[model samples]
Target chain A: MSMTMTQKILADHAGLKEVSAGQLIEAKLDVVMANDITGPMALPIFKQMADHVFDKDKVVLVPDHFTPNKDMKSAENSKAIREFSREQCLTHYMEQGKCGVEHAILPEQGIVVAGECIIGADSHTCTYGALGAFSTGVGTTDIATGMATGELWFKVPSAIKFVLKGELQPYVSGKDVILHIIGRIGVDGALYKSMEFTGDGVASLTMDDRFTICNMAIEAGAKNGIFPVDEITREYMQKHSKKVYKEYQADEDAEYDEVIEIDLSKITPTVAFPHLPGNAHTMEEINESEKIYIDQVVIGSCTNGRLSDLRKAAQILKGKKVADTVRVMVIPATQKIFVECIREGLAEIFVEAGCAFNTPSCGPCMGGHMGVMAKGEKCVSTTNRNFVGRMGDTEALIYLASPEVAAASAIAGYIADPRKAGN
Target chain B: MKAKGTVLKYGDNVDTDVIIPARYLNSFDAKELASHAMVDIDPTFTQRLKPGDIMVAGKNFGCGSSREHAPLALKTAGVSCVIAQSFARIFYRNSLNIGFAILECPEAAKDIDEGDQVEVDFDAGVIKNLTKDKKYQAQPFPEFLQKMIQANGLVNYVNQKREGKL
Candidate 1:
């Protein structure tokens, strides 16, 4: 039977001849990860559930969310992971400087490979799907089950195919494409379904762009999002991957629940207004309709903190100062990305533009600390979710946009289009 | 198999961020997390809610983030069950893994009101709102899932498996 890429991967992992949506199957995992926030909780649950980890090497723990130890409690939480790693002899535990955001660090370190099943105690675990891997997020208890047994049950999810066509205009990117889709689909349109991106337009998206797109799949309630393995994927894997991996694709006659054709040329820079990623607006609408003021601009997170994103933000910030009324916070997704930004002089450009460059952390994005919003204040962010009170102060508003839009907004002290901002 | 409680109602898209908030995530203790459950959305929630209260909400309850804290907080705060029009996938799985009772009954969600006296029969998949005197049907759990829930979550289920008690 012809199968979608998701079905093919699940069937292979579950040791089945074929599988369909809604079938329950227990499958082995190639990798399972948990961050500090979830790791502390999962550890106790794992200890209660089993005597030892199912596979020490396959379990990875990264303390990125409250890294550098936000408080004594955070320090204690991180210490639980460190001690568990020692007790279990875990191999992939990452500490400060060595650790980055789990989603970014996993792919960069080659921990997630094509056609493998990966699970993390993080909603953004879908980010790995960009590399042609099948990945999804689970809760701490689910992570505990995966840790104890190296297996968990999955309900096969129907898939929605998005065939993107046409060339992207200047300032338009993968972020715009995803925002446009979310706008059309609403936050729950693809509930419990896989979102597969295909077509010639995908070939034009860089690895960074692909990562950004797949990372936000969860915003639209997708189980996972994937792109087929093409030359771009192969090249990225060759450079970063250590183990051999097989390429997988959906069969020609694979069944799909829905197919959406998107014209990239029709997309422009866009933003998701207060409280929901599905509340999208075009750059023209936001800039021309009214003056949307902002008190801050944040340019980092698993969603848009790659080196390419940094370079673009810096390009826009070049020779321009951040508006005196607005504060800008720049964070690289990982230590490696931070190094690259510094080496490429992007760090210097940001500093010269009066933007504060912070160390790699899930900082401000999760509202844990570093740059939380004050009541009634507004922020333009490159992070994925804008759910109410996502970054502190329920009354404060968050607008999600691409790096280009965020950078320009930082300079304008309000929501502004990149085209209108002087290069 | 059965639970009775007063209703603590909420609207659609009650995301994880507001359910427990990230500020309180540093602690994993269910009790600590519980103290703040629904505090942001309903400031008097912790004060008004007593043990064994049933939570009814509109569509997509627990929509953002995969943190189990959201469900754990609600469960610890004396929420006997959550009946919603729909749920985010991760939240649904997390609630089940933690042995929390959650049901999808659009009719019940629409028919029930805040402060309603309610009773649920887990095995029969029935929810009764005594205040409104309405009975609503829910999707029954499959046998396997029912067994897992009966064990009070995956941890206990795994423990039973390890002891050859399955």
Candidate 2:
């Protein structure tokens, strides 16, 4: 009978008293997002239906994935989005490298807020749930509908409480926690609910760690993943949000469909194997005595390519050259983060380390033009998901790991341990 | 709601990438999308599917991706309704917004088969697999959703409300 966090957020946003899971509700959207991959296709459909742009304030068009135009198709698509943003007089259209990723840059730019519903045409839109917003990704067509009408309808989802305790191990991080959670839940668990990650462990996570967890919520089949606001969230708000706002939390007795407890301390540095996040293996499971072949090592995405992620990768890669056989690709999540890395000389280290540092884009993460994998190539990536051919040729393999794992693997030319490589 | 269809059946984890693959990502037309719908996962889905065949699938149906085209492709493929045990968040929201019926029936797929003749009453939230004498619960549509479904789609629903025709 009690309103869960998502229900509460929806109620308040929709101007209602309360709502329940599976109950249809008309809610006001706090932010609606679309990326270059989806926006160019969906925006034209929106134009076909309506004569004018919808409310520009709520719309955010981000040019990521393929930025600065990778090819003719990508170039034209980015240009089309730019033209649409101009025609609509939208203020939130982030150009190449200006916004690292729709999922990353928006929150840092203060577009994502606590206790609201956000939609993006990019699946990674679920990443915003880290801030306690009920965000999810939709198709371009649905975005077109949202653009025409300022309102969208949602059936409140059953919430799954992921209660965490203990602490992350030295080499382990939030990415490990999520991978472990996924390992426990299996590929199909949390199929249709929001995974609200809470408990003592949550409070200990820095914003970046929390982002890493929420960013992969989609892989678990959850609509969104969320963490309650805390001091770290408050600090992030201070730096990002121009206009400060109040925070909301779940009621202590709030009802949930299911609750899971995770002992963060028990988690280890994990790798999502051959084809899915659920196929997890702890470092001990890997035969480190033997070498693995890798064609690429990418340490970024909206998932783990934040400022902290870059710093972590830089720490591992500094003074070490990427393996002769490996091509290390480092992508910053946002222009601000990219600029900061340049200012700190971290970008220079990556370049000097035999790494190919690219401009801010979702590049290689989605295999959208930049750094796409060839058939049979093996890649260690900080990005989430390893669905077959998800990154490129079906024969290519993607290993999901933390930035530390990815960078170290790049240097060793295989799936190597950062600590061992550091030594 | 102005829905006319029998029914079809599918299994779980029916992802969007399966509905319309990235190979066809360049095409934007609903008709073009319809032709390729489920062609990846169910190679015969488009060819064998008849007009107005509602699809009933297992839990976590339509997971992955934010492409609204997944729903549009189904609609274009003549899928009248989608009765699933569960649906990923984005697909569910997008389906309702685009005037597609997505009912949560925890036991829907378990009770029905591929050739089942089905009838769904949006107001009642009930699915009748007329062939098997099986029935499933589809949570009745809320006021907002009922109106949208009745209007045939989001655009029409909004337009009707704006014109004071609802």
Candidate 3:
């Protein structure tokens, strides 16, 4: 039987010839991950199951959420994960000075590669799907179980094929593409299903773009989002990974529950308004309406805080000054990206533009700390999820947009179109 | 398995962030987490919630994050079971892994109102609204899920399997 890419990977991991949608099977895991928030919760349960993890090398832990010690509780949370990693003798544990966001650093460190079955306690673990891996987020207990057994049960998910046809417009990136798609399909559009990106347009997106797209797959309620392995993927793996990797391709006759065609050229700079990632509006739509002003602009997160994202924001903010009314925070995803930003002079550009360039952290994306908005405040952010009170005050409003739009909005002190801002 | 409770109704996409906001994620204390359950969306949720209360909501409930804290918060806050038109996959899996009961029934979610009393029969997949005198059938759990629930949760099920008792 013809099988989709996800099905093929699942079957291979499960040591079966074939697996179909909704078929429950026990598959070996290539990696099991947990962050500070979830890691602490999983440790006690993990201890209950076994004295040691299934494999020290395979169980990865990162304390990114409240790292740099936000408060007494957050400090304690990070301390638990640190102590557990030492006790377990885990090879992949990432500490504060060396760690970035879990999703961003894992790939950069080459710990996750194509055709592997991976699970992380953080929802954005789906980000690894950009490498053509079958990855999904799970609860702390699942993480604990995977760490103990090196295997977990999964119901093979049916897939929705997104055939991308054209090249994206200028100033439009993967953030816009995902925002546009989520806008078209409500938040639950791909619930419990694999969102497989295919077609010629896939080659047009950069690795950073693909990462941005896949990172927010959870926002669309997808089991995972994947891009087919290509030259770009191979080159990325070659550069960062030393481990041998496998690649899987979908059968031409692979079954998909539904097929949605996306014209990439038609996708413009888009933004998801306050309250939901699915509440999207294109730059064109926002321009036609009343000006939506803001109090802050955050240009970073696991979603869009990669090197390219920093460059995109810097390109728009290069010589421009942020509006006096708006406070802009630029956070690079990882320490490597942070150093590169400084090397590339992007940090200077941000500082010159009056933006606060902070250390690598998840920061304000989940409202853990740094750049928290006040009540009645509004922020234009490049992060994923605009759910109520996500950033800070329950009354604060968050507008999710691309880094370009975020920079432009900061300059204009309102939600402004990136395409129009620089020019 | 059965549960009966008063209903606390909500609308579509009642996300995990709102169910238990990120700000309070530092502490793993059950009671502290429960104290802030649904604080973002409904500040008085803990005050309004009582033991054996049934929470009902529209489509795509628990729509964000993989935080088990969300379900743990609701369960500890005394929500007996959650009935929704649909649920986000991670949240669905998390709820079951923790042995927090949840049912999906569009009709029941749509017709159920706040202050109504409802009872659920997990084995029979029935949801009866005692206040409205109406009944709705929920989507039954799959065999594996039913087994997991029977074993109390994923951890227990794993333990049982290791002991060759599953």
Candidate 4:
């Protein structure tokens, strides 16, 4: 019997000859992670189980959400991880200056590798699947168990193959593609299934685009979203990855529970309206009928906060000023991305375009702190998960879009297509 | 283990942000998190829910962030268990790891109504609606997971294993 990439990785880790979807197997984890908020909670549970980590090198703790000590409580929360890392002598503890978001930094620092099984306490752990790793999110207690035992059980998930065809239209990025897919497939469409990207269109996507796609897989209730490693992935690995990894792919005969075909050229800059990522609309659809105004435009997060995303946004924002009524904030996903932005003068461009530049953090993406929304305010954000009250007041609305659309919308003070925005 | 509760029904794709909201996640206290549970969707949720109530929901319940806060809030708010047609993968594991009861039964989820009196027998893996006089078979927990929950969460379960007490 042929197996998908997910099955092959799980079978190897579990030391089984073969495994199928829905089969429960205990597998060793290559990397275990938790962010500040979840890590602090897991610490007490970890203490209850054991005083030390099972493998310090394998355990990674980073404080991205509410980091840099947003408040006394947040400071205390981060303090827990800091103390635990010191006590355990963990090798991968990312301090404030060293850390960005967990998802971006993990791969950037070569902590998350290809063909490995990773479990993070945060849900976006699926982001690493872009690198061909079998990664999933767990809760605090699950992190505690993984920390103590370095192993956890998984019920292998079936695969959903998304075959992409045609070239992406101008400014129609991976965010638009993912939002479009999520719109077609309801929020629960891929429940407990892997959404695997394939075909020529996927090959045309950059690693940044693939990361943006996989990062939002959770919005469609997918266990993980993955892309096969190709030359682009190998190039990315050469620069950032510390260790060599074996490339993994699904067999041509591998069975998929469902197959979805998407034409990239048919998609345009899209936005997920208030309340859900599934309520997606192309810019043309909204421009045709809706009269919407925006209060803020946030361009960042694990979804679209990489250097490539920043450069794309910069391309749209250069020599243009944001609308007087709308505030724009651009945050890099990782410090490395921020440094690269500075090196490339993207920071200067954003500031010249009247956008506020923030240090790398989850920031307004989680609504935990920084650039929070007010009641009745509307925001176009380049982040995943637009559920109500996500960015601030429950009355405030969030629109999920690509960084290009977000930047274009910032200039227009409402939802606008990047193609029409004066570049 | 057996439990009984009144049902509080929710709709599909009830995500974590609405479950606890990110604004209130600054604190690590479960009780504090419980105070604001479901307020975004139903402001009177905490006030209306009685202790040991059961939450019945449509498919893909808990389908957003992997924050344990969602399950922690429900459990802290005295929800004994959540019965749904399906659940988001992480949320399902989070609920089990926290020792909160969650049963997936499509028929029960479809048939159960709000304010229904429900009883669950974990050993028998069955959910009975006393108000409707209906019984639905639930997927039984595997032996290992059952032991983990029996030990009152993964923490205790792992502790026992380390000490050879399991």
Candidate 5:
């Protein structure tokens, strides 16, 4: 049977000759992950099922969501997971000071690699598919099961093929590409399906761009988003990971539910308006309407907090001061990336530009801390989701955009096109 | 298996954030979580929600975040089951893992109105709207899922398997 990349990987892990869409199979997991919030929730269930995890090395715990102890409650929750990790002697537990967002650090630390089946207790776990892994999010109960027995059930997903052509225009990054796709397909466009990206245009995207694209696959309700392993992927793996990785390619006859063609060059710097990621509009469309103002700008998150994302923001913010009316917060995804930003003087640029450069945390992205909005406020953020009440009061609004747009908006106090904004 | 309840309807993309906002996720107590369930969308959800109530919504229900707290919140708040036109992938698995009942039926989801009395027959894959005097068909759970529900949840099922009682 001819199988797609996701199917081939699942079949190999399941010890099956072949599998098809919607077929249920129990497959071995290469990695099982949870963060502070879900980690503590799964402990009691994990204890009830088994005294020890199936494999300590295979289990990873990162305290990120409300880290730096947002409050007394978050502090206690962090302690619970900390103690649990120490008790289990888990191989991949990251302490608060040393940790980053789960999705960002996992790939950066070489914990998740190609041709692996990984599950995390966070929706953005699909981010690893950028590295050619079959990864998806699960609940606390699923995490408990995975910890107790390094295996979990899966329903193989049918796929949607996105064929890309042409190179992206300047100021357009992977965030725009994904936001454009999500807007076109609506939030649930790829529900219960795998989004497989291919075409020569793939070669033009940096690894950071691919990671950004795959990170928000969940925003479109995709089970996962994957790219075929290429020279760029191999190079990234060689730099970060010591684990030998395997590569899988879809057969020529691989069945796809639908095929969508995307012209990367035509994708302008895009933004998803209030409420839904599917409410996407390009800068041209947005500029033609009444100018939308904002009270705050957040230029970081797992979605666009990588090195390239930071560089883009810093380049635009170097000499420009943010609007006196808007508050700008820039957060790196991990501790390592944070230090690298400072070393590269991007930190200096942000501070001199009157922006608050924060430590690595998912803060403000999920409205946990750092920059929660007030009632009747508006924000342009580089995070993935902009659901109602995501950042603060239900009345407040969120506009999802690329780092370039976010940085520019911080200066203009309204959503602005980066290319046209004064430097 | 069967469930009966009055419906509480919502529109499309009823996301996890609104179902159980991230601000309240610091607590693991099911009751504490339940107290705030759907508060973002309806500030009076906890007060209005009665035991054995059914929550109904339009397309792409539970669209954001993989926080199982969404399902746990609804289940603990006495939501007997949820009927939606469709559900996000992670939310679907999370519901079943916790033994929460959910059905996908476009006709019922579209026709069912707030405060309508609804009855679901899981074995027969039928949803009866008593208030509307209508019946709609939904896909039944597969054998494994049916067994998991019978065991009360995945935790119990795993325990039974470990003891060779499966």
Candidate 6:
């Protein structure tokens, strides 16, 4: 069988002679990560079972989700995680501004790389797949095992090809592309397969764009999403990582279990409905729905909180203040991004437009802290996942859209198209 | 570490929230987690699971959250081993770190059913599903890993290391 770059990496590292689609193969693991929040509980379990401290080098810890705790409970949770990190002698524990978010920090620190199998105590661990590794998120127990034993099991999954052929239109960021894909393939469409993203349109995107696209692959229930290292990848790696990376590309004759072609040009700026990424809609289509009153409009997360996303939201919100009734919050994915937004004056633009920006944490992504909407309140968000009560009350509603839509919605205090405000 | 147990079947995408929901993230007690294992998905996984029942899941088992309560819940609930087609990354590692036998039988999930008496040989990297009378391949534990497993978990392993037996 023709093998794609990802397949080859998984197969070769799995210690098997050769692997085909849907074949079960277990591979050796190279890296493992956990954050302060998850690591606290997980380390105790690890301590209960294993006699050794975690291999200091193989483990990484970041305090990203709740950088600025709003209350004492969260503060205690953060404190526990810090104490656990110190006790375990974990070498890498990122601070608020030093490094931010588990996913971006690991890669930025050269901890995540190609041909590695990494298990993090976070769900978005699949973000590393963009660099050619087989990576996925898991519960806290799993991170403990990887750190303790340095191994993980994997059933070779069938590949689903997402072939993109057209360029994205103006104001349409990579987040929109993923939202469009989610719309086409509901939330659980790729439940047990690797969603391999390829095609000409992929060449047009940068590394950050690819990361944003792949970061949300798990939302579609994909085992992982990947784009082979290209010039764009090389450029990003050269600037950030000093280590060498082995990149993979799908073979020309590689066979995919299923193929879905997408014309990026055909996709309009879209939104995911109240409880799933799979439910997608264009602004025009959404205009027909009952008016959506948003209590909050957020623009950040592993999904859509980047310099580009911030810039776009700033562009749309510049000079136009958000409605008094709407509360807008932005969480930069990492410290670098927060720095960039400030450096480029996008931070000012957003703040000037009534959008409050927070540090690089997953504050509102889990609905735990930061901007939790009230019962029956509605929110438009850019982060992944809009499950019932995901970011607020169970009775609260959520609409997932690109940063542009979120910004526009903040101004109008209801779901409105950014294009309509084309002042 | 080697363990023998009965097979307990589960379907796909058994997430962490199902194992131990977000609401129960507080507290680090093992028994506390075990009591809530699979409460969200089955609400009976804990009560129904026998002391030596080994859990086997189809694919994407433990797919959400980094909650450590999952494996702790499974271990405390009396699951002996977990053999799955695939695991969400974190759960796989967590299971091992906590000393629960996680046998990587990528195909065993598809082959075995509920209530199959299985023998998991960590040193040999194979699972004998006695009920099905089939022996499925599993990744053998390396020498270092065997020591870690025998010690029961990471903390135990560290203790053993401190004793200079590692």
Better of 1 and 6 by lDDT: 1
Per-residue lDDT tens digits for candidate 3, residues B1-166, read 8999999999999999999999999998888999999998898999988899999999999988999999999999999999999999999999999999999999999999999999999999999999999999999888998999999999999999999998
Candidate 1 error regions (>4 Å): B162-164
Where is model 2 more than 4 Å wrong at Cα?
A: A44-54, A288-292, B1-11, B34-57, B74-85, B100-144
- Comparing 1 with 3 on TM-score, the higher-scoring candidate is 3
Model 4: colliding residue pairs:
none
TM per candidate, chain B: 0.95, 0.88, 0.98, 0.96, 0.96, 0.88
State the DockQ of every prediction: 0.81, 0.37, 0.87, 0.84, 0.89, 0.23
Model 3 spans with C-alpha error above 4 angstroms: none
Interface RMSD of 3: 0.7
> In candidate 4, what are the lDDT values of residues A1-423, reduced to their tens digit?
788888888898999988988888889999999998899999888877777889988999999999767889988889889999999999999987766988889988988878989999988899999988898888888998899899987888899999999889888899999999999998988889998888888788888888889998888898888888888888888888788687788989899999889999999888999889999898889889866889999998989999889999999999899999999989998989998999999999999989999988999998987799999999999989788889999899999999999998998988888998865
What lDDT is obtained when candidate 1 is compared to the true structure?
0.91
lDDT (C-alpha, whole model) for all candidates: 0.91, 0.79, 0.93, 0.89, 0.93, 0.75
DockQ winner between 1 and 6, please give it.
1
- Pairs of residues clashing in candidate 1: none
Q: How well is candidate 5 docked (DockQ)?
A: 0.89
lDDT by residue for model 6 (B1-166), tens? 5678777788876666567655445455678767867765576777778887888887767665556677777888888778887765556656666677777667788988887788887777888888878888886665555666777765566557657887
Q: How many backbone clashes does candidate 2 have?
A: 6
Report candidate 4's interface RMSD in Å. 1.1
**TM-score of model 3 vs. true structure:** 0.99
The numbered model that scores best in DockQ is: 5
Per-residue CA lDDT of model 3 for A1-423, tens digit only, reads 999999999999999999999998899999999999999999888887899999999999999988777999999998889888998899998988787999999999999999999999999999999999999999999999999999998989999999999899888999999999899888999999999999999999999999999998888899999989999999999999998899999999999999999999999999999899999998888999999999999998899999999998999999999999999999998999999999999999999999999988888999988899899999999999899999999999999999989998999999999898846
Which ranges in model 4 have alpha carbons more than 4 Å from their true place? B162-166
**How would the candidate models be sorted by DockQ, starting from the highest?**
5, 3, 4, 1, 2, 6
